[model samples]
Target: MGRKTEQTMRTYHRYLGFFLAGIMAMYAISGIVLIFRNTDYLKKDVQVEKKLEPQLTVANLGKAIHKKNLKVEKEEGGLIYFETGTYNTITGEAQYLEKRLPLILDKMTKIHKANSDHPLFFLNIFFGLSLLFFVVSAFWMFRPNTPIFKKGLYFTLGGVLLTLILLFV
Candidate 1:
């Protein structure tokens, strides 16, 4: 590559690395948390109150509250009881006790799992592109003939091999 192109890559890579350091840390932490999501690690049960659409049926209550497999276990007077909490049919109020990670960790996990329906999806795309740029620009950081660059290639190959092994095993 041209000297100018290599210089540009190095400059942008350095600045982007500095800019994205915090977000990268967040992704790493959140990713680790998600691996143990099936367990109750770092979780506490808290009461949550939500105002949903009024006069919802038991079948639709789960969708409104964003829970799955939720059913009304019983009904007494104006309240519908479920495994986690109760909903007042007369009003649009739902009160549930749910186990969740702490607020900040929960928010981080939400960002980590953002979909197309969420605004954080754009951030996901940007972060993915930034990571791709980092991978490519790293090659420009050192000349291909250097010992450091040769050692880096060996490390990169090892990483790729490890990833493939984990994928199949």
Candidate 2:
């Protein structure tokens, strides 16, 4: 509650906010793009052909093609059929239609959705903790008894309420 402590908190908050601005913008843009991922918006379809080891089973074919939740609609003779394309068991050939975002956009989305396997997972943890620090540092910007801080508390509560509403709906 001392004057020097408040000043230090504000300084850290200000600089950290500036330092994270670029990454924050990237996440915002990536989030918006991901909302349209199910659709072909800003995406291009390409005919992809792959040649793997022959005689792969349906599960193995899915693994070879790097597809998840692959459904084998129908299998006839040597060909395995799926929603996007076909695989030949005897030939170890795969031909499929693949929808892809532009290279930079694709990288952005991948960074946004970093998993534990990715090197960026540690960066994600740091970024998440930094964001939490920003939230806590905001309270230190003003003393609790001030009118402005009281008003900020109301605004914060409103934001929390809105988030809860969005979560259920």
Candidate 3:
């Protein structure tokens, strides 16, 4: 590539690296948190004690948990639990583990999980393609014969090999 092209690639790589730094951090943290999904360590425990109205039906449990109108078909023991909503009844409290990501990170994560109905689906696709372009452009940022480029090539090969092994092995 010409000097100007190389410089332009380097400039793009540097700025994109900076723009993605915070997002990278969020993904790292959320990824780690997601790895321990089977545990409650990352979740905050909420305790609630309230006197439910007498003559309550098993069907009315969802309302007792502040999620009224929830379809609850049965009541077990002193508690009524909704099949798909919040639960708060009896001495035993319902555990709600929630994590609120920062606005930008949250939006990015939502875009990643976007469906066709999501308004930012097109933008998400564009950003993803731009990232792929950046990855391909990285090679031209350095001279083909440079040691760093050679080392990077070797590392890239090793990473691919490892991924393939993990996928099939």
* lDDT, candidate 1, at 133: 99
Residue 107 miss distance in model 1 (angstroms): 2.2
Model 1, which residues run further than 4 Å from truth?
53-55, 76-78, 90-92
**TM-scores of all predicted structures:** 0.83, 0.87, 0.59
Local lDDT at 147 for model 2: 100
Residue runs of model 2 more than 4 Å from their true location after superposition: 69-77
The global Cα lDDT (0 to 1) of model 1 is 0.93
Task: Kindly list the per-residue Cα lDDT of model 2 for residues 1-112, writing each as its tens digit.
Answer: 8889899999999999999999999999999999998899999988899998888878888788888788999989989899999988888889999899999899999999
**Residue 103 Cα positional deviation in candidate 3, in Å, after optimal superposition:** 11
> Local distance difference test, per candidate?
0.93, 0.92, 0.64
Using lDDT as the measure, which candidate wins?
1
User: How many residue pairs clash (N, CA or C atoms closer than 3 angstroms) in each of the candidate models, in the order given?
Assistant: 0, 0, 1
lDDT of 1 at 103: 91
Best by TM-score: 2
Error of model 1, residue 54, in angstroms: 5.1
Could you give candidate 1's per-residue lDDT for residues 13-113 as a string of tens digits? Answer: 99999999999999999999999998999999988999987788887999888788897789988899999999998887999998899999999999999
